[model samples]
Target: MIEFWLCAGLLLLTALAFVLIPVLRGRKLQAEEDRTALNVTLYQERLQDLQAQNAAGALNAEQLAAGRDEAARELLADTEGAQALPPQRTLGIKVPLVFALLMPLLGYGLYQHWGAIDDVERARTFADQPKTIEEMTARLEAAVKSDPKSAESWYFLGRTYMAQERAADAAQAFERAIEVAGRAPELLGQWAQALYFAGGKQWTPQLQALTDEALKADPAEVTSLGLLGIAAYESGQFKQAIGHWQQLVAVLPAEDPSRQAIQGGIDRAREQLGEPVEEAAVSAGPGLTVQVALADDLQAKVQPGDAVFIFARAVSGPPMPLAVKRLTVADLPAEVRLSDSDAMMPQLKISGFEQVQLVARISRSGNATAGEWVGSSLPLASKTTEPQQLLIDSADSKAP
Candidate 1:
């Protein structure tokens, strides 16, 4: 706020100076006009004197002609000089006063309304925050509107929405970006990620096509390889999955969290295929349940393809958010119950909190459409109760 005031004050003062400078150095119109008139009168008087001498027969014809020519020349020179000076404008006090007042106001108004300064500041702040998948989607929408041509913004939007489990929106956004960007590697990777996640239980040849295209462009892209490995792993293509994972491991840092995650996944794939498990010191936590309930039925207004954000926070800690989950409407249950047994639940540590705050939200377009949050007193060590269920039907006294 202080910074805002300082900037505004500086602008106002600058405008004030602009107005005062012109007023202070203003030309003296009255004095210049008087001087011009006096010169013209003096030249006319000299010409009259010459004419009188000629009329009195005290001057020859040549002398009279020369005197007349000289007088004419002097008169012409004075006229031209007067014309060379700019004419002065006599403004009422209101003109400068209005200008002085309006200049800063107009400038500040424009700056506040359409300037990039504030948007950039907002963007920086948003980036600094721990963005939930839903929040990232909204921010991506804002960023795209603010700068439509930014490829990075568009790509990030597609990726983020995909992460939030909004496949259709992700596909559409990716398609739009692809129209503008053509076949860039990063864009292909983003699009492939969306497709891979969206296909879910029915991932098939279509998923492979996007993955192939993405890998063709950038063979070493860790995300592309990771998705390919997962897809192959899911389809019981153990060799193929191992091949992809091994490539990813080679390219990724050994200490990368993602590497550890992929390794764990690869280990599972190997075990499923009757291969030996690689024993890595992974901190495995106890499993728990995550229940998403709506206060009322939201299916009529929300689609299965829409994005839903799920988050859990510990009851007794800094709001440093414990776990976040995102899924498409398709992944959501009418009142979904997630147990620790689910593989994707690994990314979210449900066992970490004894008492936690759980929130479920769905965004229509880019705004929140349906949401329910529960502050549960249940401990992780305690037996999971009828997994916290959220009913979608609203219990409002008035119609929505």
Candidate 2:
């Protein structure tokens, strides 16, 4: 918000500066013209002298005519010499023209290139969305299997473990990645976050060292800012937290999710320290949970944390689409249940499911990309029944 206001203020001031310069220049020119009055005086004196000379017969008709022409030329030069000095720039015209034409175009070009408003928002949504431990672990295993040398995969796996509240596992993953990746700023940031989470809410020397490393690599790192701010707040350094968050807000765009997220955190810290919070509660909206499992036949080969997508279609009548759930391996269970009870489950009449199909597949990322189909597409008698089970064999899982 402050950054936006500052840019807007600068643009406005530039516009005014352009507007007033021409007006002042024009007024100065007019005042000079009025004060000098040299043209009028010179022309009158020349005309009177010529008339007297002509009357005294000291000048012939030709002489009088030539003298009159000379006087006229001198008068013209005095009156028009200032016009030849230089052309004055008119801000009244140019300023509005530039603002009208270039402002919108320049603003649009800038937005199209570096203004990652929507892209950042989408990434934020992905980041904030919940993932089960099984799903994350499956992804990590697959990533490692595919490319054992990828430090980024290891770092992500560590971060994922941290998300699942498995701090020790996360730390180990981060450590391994650091050994291979070697001091990447983003990796350091994630490593520090994991260390802090594992350290029982106290800043350990190791964690502080990682934090310092991350900040040194990139002072504007968002994760670093968040971690540092939290540390400051916890240590009763409310003002320090505010300063970090304030700097973050300045760097982030006006519509950035992190901007709001960090600002809210800062406000809460301030309020806790007896300072006024500038915002109200932010609503994150409703959430849903879904589970997918492979059939019993496929259990030996199917991993729990594999990624899967579940689709349910009504069996009878028009054969309408019923529901679709995307899930990861960590979310799978021996028996899968779909009902209104799950927090993430969407609202359905709960009576429309005639037949349900389950499939398990291994995605390119080492996670379950698909689910094996179970039972026939035949019509079901009721929606609410015992939980459905889909089984797949281990041998089949490795098959193409």
Candidate 3:
């Protein structure tokens, strides 16, 4: 700010010079013009005295003429040689002075109106290096208060809060950051991490949602992979933790400080499982508990041996099921659990989607893709905790 004022003052001074220099020169020229006028008046008086002497017979004609000529020569010498000056320019000091004063005032006014003063203040707020994590967190909190619209400020504040283990505050800050900066993968991961910690690392459906959404946006998002691994490890799913951490390690830079810690975590997971987990370990997401029953009217329509296929598919993604479970009409009114352990493929699981649709179909033709009777639940979170009840009453005449 001091430098800013210094530069502004210099510019204002330059403008004043432009306005005042000409006014000062005009004053000098006016003085010379006054002297020239005085010389002309004196010359006229001397001529008049010479004519009076000639008329009064005080001097001969020659003397009178010589006296008049001498006056003229003196006038020329005084006016041209001593008092000569450039032509006078019309100048009003009042206007120039007014403009000179207004120059600085106007500059200051415009700066106050449009300058990036808030940005400067934000810089200052962050410039004072903090000696400890607490100090850094306080500074970042101040910065965000000063500039609430700055997404960058909020992000750093959230990270600092995380370092302090203030998970709820960190979650709020990260949510604000995402609101301002858009749902970029990195921001989403931070939001998920904060929420995950805030909930005591219980790995709620919402946390799973945030992480899944982040990974969907960016497959190699390191933060999402790390959080997923941590959640799996917490839930005693060491094989699944190994799979997620392996993916995280593959994308991390060789020199990254977290790389060693992540590798250590992976090693621990392997030891827990007593083996090097392969892709097979990837099938470790929580199962969905559901009660499926035949509608009273459709009880006769479904045969006892008719294959009942229960599956989960992303609400807005590929047609393939993330996980599936097979049953029969005889299993109607039975409780079943569909899980990643029942994944249709090694690479796909319920954990891959933020929201999922539950589907149950009676494929009498033995074609799982095209069935005779099907029922579907509206999209629910993939990690929904409470058991869902579904009725198999709808026709599945439409093509898949």
Candidate 4:
């Protein structure tokens, strides 16, 4: 903010210089003209005295002629090298001087009305990572204040408020986001979640309506699915809870950490209804088991946190993965199962393809399509039940 104000001050000074420099020059030219007029007046008075002397016979004609020549010479000397001045403008100097005086005030006024100085300050504040939740909340609040129309800002601010357990504030932030960005399915889901918490976790018609609207727009919307499951469980609707959670489990990626918690909720709901827990039912699908390991030489180059993507891609169809599982380099040498339930999309599943290629890639940046190290197996039957060995043993020549 200080830097912004400093730059503005410098620019204002430059503008004043442009306006006032010419006015100063005009004043100096006027002074020179005044001096020339005085010199001409002295020359005229000397000529008049000489003419008076000649008329009184106090001096001979030649003497008078000499005095006249002297006066003329003196006059010429005084006016020598004077350039003819251009016609002066009636308002040039005065107008610019007045404008120069008002420029700073007018600029400040216009800027206060329309400038993005607060945005500049917010940008500078956001450049550095916030070290605490309070700091993060403060930064996010300022960001929304600076750019109320920025749906992204409002969305993140709402998320931050949620983290801080300020449910009411979070609800308001999400509402603002919906106003700016429209009722996007994700935003609707978040807004419903916030409102539910803000209303003391009690299920309400408003909450139900919001979730319904969100799911109507996007059936796979995760937040609404989870929130609905929770509400059903709390209300003793075990069967409804199970249904909602199962749908959520189906849409979530296989490697999502939240899957375990959600599955726990499903099992609890089933137990509440006196049904036997069925773990296999959740993951039952055609799958390929693979043992993945990092290359010995490249192990030293990778960090424990580096992302390892293990997936199967169709050999004769689209390049998109049939199924995928994500892990970290620290989890290398571990066995993973890529199954129909792990499919990236519902229509694209391991069972849908005839032949597939198994791939293991290590990416420092967590991108599945491109990575630093990769290994792949030749095309094989998608229904192959045998476990296979895959290694990240080669540099990824196709990495971008």
Candidate 5:
């Protein structure tokens, strides 16, 4: 900030020079004009004295003429450069001097009204990585203070508050972000999570509304799903917890590091439900192979680029898929296998379900739950090894 102000001062000085240099030059020219007038007055007086001397018989005509010529020569010498000087316009001099005096003030006023000085200061503050959480929090606090409308700053500040375990403060920060950036699903989820933690893990109607709003906008919002799972687990709603965590697991990428932790949560929830935990190390167990194909009548209804989801769900258990695979319509008639390795949740494997149903759905919108066409297989043993045929021949009546 000091450096910024120093640079601004230098520029201000440069601008003043442009306005003031002309005013100074104008003063010098005015002084030269005054001197030229003085020299002319002296020359006229000398000429008058010479003429009087000649008329009074003190000198002859030739001598008087010689005196006048000497006066004329002296006047010419004094005013030699006066004619070359551009005519001094008093009209412009005062106005420029006034403008020079006011330029700095005007510039400062305009900058105060419209300049991004605070942003510059904030940028300088953030140039270096903060060494501590407290330092980072302080910087973010200052940033939001300087730029209250900056949604990004508010978001970071909220995250930093959460890191510092100031849940209530984090909730406020997230709320500010939502206000400034509109109620984005991610921000809504964060706000709900913060409020949940701030209230001592107590679920409230407000929190429910916030989470519902977020999930409604984006069903796969990870933060909201995770938060709901945590709240359900704490409230002795193990089934609900499992449902939420399973959704989260399904949306997370296969390589995401957080998937392990979420799976751990799901396992814990399952334990609370007294579900038998398989003691043996789960490996690639017997998987069901299914060949999926689009129906001939529906060929014109779906694009080749549409997503097709193939999965196995328990016949009478939770609705979440045990294993799933995704492909495009162009890959119709493709053979895919569903095994424990493709499980959405670590504890929810196809091998755990005695009877499962195979499902194939073609969704132009890429949503697994909702699609334009779907096909299903009758209740079959999870250990079925032979390849089964599936056809997307029916309209997706379950799709909303």
Candidate 6:
């Protein structure tokens, strides 16, 4: 701002020079005009003296004629090199001074009302690279506030919010971006991710709709596919997770930094389901029923779409599940049966375990192997006819 004012003041002075130059020259011309008039007055007075001398009879005719000729010569000499001056204008220094003051004031006033000073400052601020994410985000927030309809500003703000883990705010910023910039598929995917995380990693119909819409618009939309994979994996739908992740991987360039992580996730998912990477998965099982219900104390804190993993494992054996079934909080207090079809491997079966432990876990991050809540039943014989009751009333013994 100081720099701007300095430059503006210099410009105002430059303009004042134009007006001041002519006023100064007019004063110089006036001085010349006054001297010319005084010379003419003195010439007339000399002629008057000669006439008085003639009237007093102090000179002869020849002498008077000689004197008149000499007087004419003197007049010519006095007036030599004089030219007629043009009529002076009534222009005054006061008018120029008033103009000088008004020119700067009016110009400065108009500029303040509609100038790029803010933009200039913004540019300068950015040039001095911000040292932190918080600083950069602060600048973006101010930019959007000043330009509410700038789609680019909103987009970057959303990304920054996402990086800062303010998913809800990120979601709002992406929505504003789409409203201002149009429904680009990438924007939709980002918006969906923020919405998904903002809802505590629960996959709702709204989130599903957003990802579905994004993929429909651009089949290879990476964020949408990655989100779907996350949702599927957390819900213990390993095959579906593999499919989404594989698709995402295929679309990504080989040099992409995310490809390795995503591929690792796919491999982990396939391994969890005991499916060979080279072959498609097939289901088999020794089926059994378990009824799952959340303890009343925990019902208020969980999402309906949160992943629920139910499985039966040998009481004291390999520690691996013989059979597993996936559901969600929405299916609570309901009986879900796992069979040989739910076996982690082609050979593993619930029928192999004479005594098994039935377990249910609710994972917020979509990882069936780990979660925030868990419930299990005491050892029961495979021949046991009663329905096993599982209560997800306690915190999980593991972390995601």
- TM-score of every candidate: 0.51, 0.38, 0.53, 0.64, 0.65, 0.55
lDDT of 5 by residue, 1-400 (tens): 7777899899988998998887787788788878988998999899889888898999998999899889889998888867556654465677877887888899889999999898888878988755444667788899999889999999988876774458999999999999999999999999999999999999999999999999999999999999999999999999999899989989987745456557767778878889964342122246888999888999898898999999999886767677788899998879887777676545567888899999999888877777989999999998787899999999999677
Q: Number of clashing residue pairs in every model?
A: 9, 33, 0, 0, 0, 9
TM-score of 3: 0.53
Model 3 backbone overlap count:
0
Residue 301 of model 3, lDDT score? 79
Candidate 4 wrongly placed segments (more than 4 Å): 80-92, 145-150, 274-400
Per-residue lDDT tens digits of candidate 6, residues 77-145?
876776678996757779987888799889988998998776887687767644445676798899888
After superposition of all CA atoms, the RMSD between model 3 and the true structure is: 18.7
Ranking by TM-score: 5, 4, 6, 3, 1, 2
Per-residue lDDT over 117-151 for candidate 3, one digit per residue giving the tens place of the 0 to 100 score:
88887787767545444566677788788779999
Q: Which number leads on lDDT?
A: 4
Of 3 and 6, the candidate ranking higher by lDDT: 6
Candidate 1 lDDT over 1-400, as tens digits, reads 4676788788689869978766654544455677788888998899889989999999988999999899888877876645445665767457887888788779878887887764665567465544344565677787778767766667777756654558777877887788777877667666776766666646667666767787887888776787778778878898899889989888875444455556777788888888888776343333334655443345566677766655555565434334555666677564433323322223344454566655556654533323432223333432355455543343222212
lDDT of 2 by residue, 39-98 (tens): 778788989999999999999999999999998987777676555335454455555656
For model 2, the local distance difference test gives: 0.59
Better-scoring candidate (lDDT), 2 or 5? 5
**Which residue pairs of candidate 4 clash?**
none
Better of 2 and 5 by TM-score: 5
Superposed Cα deviation of residue 180, candidate 2 (Å): 2.2
- How does model 1 score by TM-score? 0.51
